[model samples]
Target: MWADKSYTEVTFKGCRPTEPASNFDKSVDIQLYTAGFGDKVGPLKHFTKCFELSTSTATWTGLPKGLYYFKIVKIGGESHELKKIDVDQVRVDTTLAD
Candidate 1:
């Protein structure tokens, strides 16, 4: 999601894959970064921060306004997989307040 103005917080709704069975017992990491940075040479070079969600919904605060992107990673060792978020099941909301 792109934020035209700085926001104190962003709300991320819980999401499930189209094929829930594929998730199994894996836990995924929700990572945030600047736009066009998530796929750079070094994945962590443009890293911002990581979020841990205890519930279906999560709110991350104190982020600067700008173009941004998210990376969903399935937790595992060296073989961890990068998962794509199901846009249909997920909702990202940022304050429209100016």
Candidate 2:
């Protein structure tokens, strides 16, 4: 997802109970990247302040918007204990500052 303007904060909720269940059972590192309004994404620019499977939520603040995407790292357990979750299990939502 892309934000049109700078945002004070952004939040990511990890799982969707409504969606089909998967073998997701571990904390993950949410890798955030940007492309400066272009299609090419830059290197690993930031990580969420907190990443946990227990809470199923991730967040980062002070983000300048253009184009962005998230990569969930260390799926399953920290050492990749559990099986990989379905691709459908991942979801992204964004709200720009008013």
Candidate 3:
């Protein structure tokens, strides 16, 4: 979703991938970066912090605003990411769960 405001209520609903290799796990390290090419939304250029959620209960406590593009970094020394996307949302459920 595209926005033109510095403040926005981004709801990280979660993700449900059919393939198990594309699911967001608990050890995933998401890296959020503002789209530096799209008019520059805010002064914030890097990720402020990271968040952790349960795969069973779909809920987000606190997600940062002013973020444009974000990537999920695979943890647990995995070769590939379980799931990755270019948005300000987080995954609440995995393929195996749902």
Candidate 4:
């Protein structure tokens, strides 16, 4: 999860497979969805972005201020959702002075 005044960049860390033999070659897929509008309200949902992680750390940037749903997909032997994240109201600080 991440929040910033100017922009939002969510950083995710990669974890080692529990069974190295079975999950060694697996890859991470990130999917972002807009939950709703105004403090995470409403039911109008939409897909926002998708990313494939190829490094130890992955970052998702340029996100608008709203509620977001994330799904981490592990693709290898069998594709499955590894985790889910819900980000509510990503705030921006427009009052910061340079």
Please count the clashing residue pairs in each candidate, in the order shown. 0, 1, 2, 1
lDDT (10s digit) by residue, model 4, range 1-98 = 32333333333333344455343453444454555432322222122322222223233345556555554444433455543333232322322341
- How far residue 17's Cα lies from its native spot in candidate 2, in Å, is 14
On lDDT, the leading prediction is: 2
Q: Rank the candidates by TM-score, best first.
A: 1, 2, 4, 3
lDDT of 2 by residue, 1-98 (tens): 55534432334444332223454443344466675533433232232222333234344455655667665544444432333433323445454433
Model 1: per-residue Cα lDDT over 1-98, one tens digit each: 56534432333434333346345333444555667555311132111222223223344455655676655544321123544333324456676452
Count steric clashes of candidate 1: 0
Single out the weakest 10-residue window by summed lDDT for candidate 4. 41-50
* Candidate 2 vs 3: which has more lDDT: 2
TM-score of every candidate relative to the true structure: 0.48, 0.45, 0.31, 0.42
The residue pairs in collision within model 2 are: 14-56
Task: List where candidate 1 sits over 4 angstroms from the true fold.
Answer: 8-23, 39-55, 75-88, 96-98
For residues 1-98, could you state the per-residue lDDT of candidate 3 as single tens digits?
Answer: 33223332223433333345345342333333456654422222222223233221222223344335534434422433444433235442212222
Give candidate 2 regions above 4 Å deviation.
Answer: 8-25, 36-55, 77-83, 87-89, 96-98
**What's the residue-level lDDT of 77 in candidate 3?**
29
TM-score of candidate 1 relative to the true fold? 0.48
